[model samples]
Target: MIRYAPWKVASIILGTLVAILLVIPSLLPVSTRESLARAAPWLPARAIVLGLDLQGGAHVLLEVDTPSVVRSRVEALRDDVRRALREDQVKLTGGIGLQAKGVQLRIPDPADRAKALPKLRQLAQPLGASLTGAVSDFTVNEGDDGVVQLMLTDAGIDARVRRAVDQSIEVLRRRVDALGTTEPNIQREGNDRILVEVPGLQDAQRLKDILGTTAKLEFRLVGDSGANPGDVEQLPYYKASEGSGTLPVEKRVMVQGEDLTDAQPGFDSRTSEPVVNFRFNLRGGQQFGQVTAENVGKPFAIVLDEKIVSAPRILGPITGGSGQISGNFTVQGANDLAVLLRAGALPAKLTIVEERTVGPGLGEDSINAGKRAAYVAAILVLGYMLLTYGVFGVFADIALGVHILLIFAFMVLLGATLTLPGIAGIVFTIGVAVDANVLIYERIREEAHSGRSILQSLDTGFKRAFATIIDSNVTMFVAAAILYLFGSGPVRGFAVSLGLGILTSVVTAVTMTRMMIALWYRWKRPTVLPI
Candidate 1:
């Protein structure tokens, strides 16, 4: 135990030095740490981030509007069925309409039903890739009365809901990240709800406003279908008084925001006003150019969430596929619109069923309480260890300190969040850290009483206590892993700290303590152990 190789000693020193460097910055003020990062980019930049429970921010539970999703899907499917029938030239019309679970079309003639059944079955395409080619999004069924029903598969709607939830989570993450919020927790709560916890967020209403809007931008032509030219779709604009005070946009969308490649907030050089400049992707650009070229003198509406943001006439063909949305918006509004366009629209509407805000004062008090508890635990553990054993106890205490520093260092490296329960885990680690030392010291006393030499007894004690330490720590590690796998939120955070502390404790207690003892022994050349 006393004869450590030169490289091993150097490695231990390096590890301890690295831990000090990484952990010290976390204990410093934010400004000071930022300055240090600027000065030395080589050092670790990530610090311990406080969780929502500790930092205090916004908490919102949003329920996905599944009914809206279903209705939209049904309407789109109904249109597809009508188009398919027209293309196939299977004429037996009562017109396609929505039913309880899907769409239904009346084929009045019984003779035409056979022709339409095969064509409608052709429309029942596979939902996605399948090895068996068994499941489809829709099932075509023919009734005795020649009424063909195109019913949506249960699997398809469930799949759609799952996709919507996943896409919503990603979009929410992008929106929150755009707001410069740190370590926001966005997760799905159930089949139809999402839970969002943002740390250090100040303006909850601003975030809500951003999330509330669907931001589904569409470009549609303004025209009338009948001889008198009746309005196609009446859309709302930002103000109630823009071009007849209502948007008379054709329901047929020419282009959509999904085809957008980029959107930036900028000022129009001619008007010196804030505007949102948007560029379309290749397919979108081609379609946009084609539409503008066809309707050179017609007005087109830019609709957002059923509201028209702008209505501009095609003065000329815009072949470049880039345009600006100018609605006399302020700089901030333009920036926000640009962000919304860039993030894309949510799949469906989200209703904030639950909203919560944790005040900064409560967070500060929680932090102080955690700190106090930790300090008290450390003081008690250190005092107990020192009273039980003399110089050996001091060595254990030093190792315990190093163990904690290393834990913080690992936490920083992993970018783990520290919650209130995680603080409790750290306090719990204090006692666990000294367990190995106590085992080793007790074993050493037993060996010394058995009449072994001081050096021999120390070596034998470490070797004998090693197995017990491994068994205990491994069991704790397994428990932590189980907790992490099954638990959520704060429980996961606690598992992280506890698991990391166990590993760090083993190294510090077994290795660092032995190293210190070995070095002290070499200097003192004592015939008897200090303990």
Candidate 2:
């Protein structure tokens, strides 16, 4: 082990020099770091980011209403069936609406029953291609009362929920990234919950505001039955006018936010006020044009999250696919709306069920405590090694320091987050790193006592101890890998630090320490070992 080739020696020296170079930027100021990055694009410019527990920030637990998404799909299906039956001129009786776990519609007339059954089955969307044919999302069945039932299949519901969760995660990532918080951690906690941690965030409330808003936008025509108490479909909206009791709007949507292609915060040229300007896709633009052209004198409500934000009259056709939404909005509000529109609406609403804030002062205290612990541990370990092994102990201590430097170098290169537990990992690593050196030195002492020369003792010690070191560090590495794969948040940080420490410890302890001892041995030509 002590006999290294010329190329191996050069490589080790080069690697150590590279580690020092890469780790230097992390310790420097931001300006110097940026300058170094500009000068050398190959170097890792960014420092290790602190975690939420270490840097202090907003921690939020949001529960997504996944059931509500399923319910809304059922409701939409009911509406579509009603519209389809009516448009096909099929006579329908009894209520056509959502039932326990499916949609139910009655065709009392025997003649129309057969006709309606075919039409209802036609509305069934194929789940995917199959050997027999397309698999439908719903199973159709007829009852003795001439009622047709469309029950949603279990596979359908499962697929819907899975898709909703996936889309929600993607949208949440986009929203958090839009906020420009540094190294924000957004991940799904369970089937219906998301955990968000934004480190170094000062305005947690603002983040809450952004996340809370569902930002669902739609356009519906203003209803005619304004004051009628007997209207079932016409619900009253207070924001339509001041003290107007209520301004009814249609239940059907003319344009959904899914059709929106772009949205930006800009000033309306005519009003010279902040507004959210939006554009739609080709199909949406055509539909919007036809609606506006047909109802030139009619007013339509622009609804956002169940509230009528604005009701504007159709003055002309908008064939350009672009329009402006002017409301009682500040510049910031308009910008926020634009951002929401651009990110697309969430699959389901998210309720902030739990929230907490960790202050920077607490993080500083944690960091200070961790540093003190590390310092004390390092001092005791260094003192013990020196007292036990003399000059050889100093070589081990130097190797230990290099082992730490390499860990930080890897952390920066890997963009690892540092937490309090990560500090614990490092301190634990300090002890473990020295343990390998201790094993080798003790083996050398044994070999020297057995009438072997110093060179023979050193070679035999490192060679025989190699297998034991490999076994111990390999086991540690496997445990850390498992932890990292299965664990979350702070546990992951610990795994990362611990894993990196294992690798660096192995490298520095085996190669660098032996190299240093070999140089010392050659220079002194010692007849007896240092210990």
Distance (Å) between predicted and true CA of 60, model 2? 1.0
Best by lDDT: 1
How far does residue 493 in candidate 2 sit from its true spot (Å)? 1.4
- For 148-207, candidate 1 gives per-residue lDDT tens digits of 888888877776777788999998888888878888889888888899989998678977
Query: Which residue window of length 10 is worst by lDDT in model 2?
Result: 231-240
Best by TM-score: 1
- Residue 131's C-alpha lDDT in candidate 1? 64
Q: For candidate 2, lDDT tens digit of each residue in 52-94?
A: 8888999988887766777877887897788888876788776
- The list of candidate 2 runs beyond 4 A from truth reads 1-7, 28-44, 83-90, 109-142, 152-159, 225-246, 270-272
How far off is residue 261 in model 1, in Å? 1.0
CA lDDT of every candidate: 0.87, 0.85
The CA lDDT at 245 in model 1 is: 66
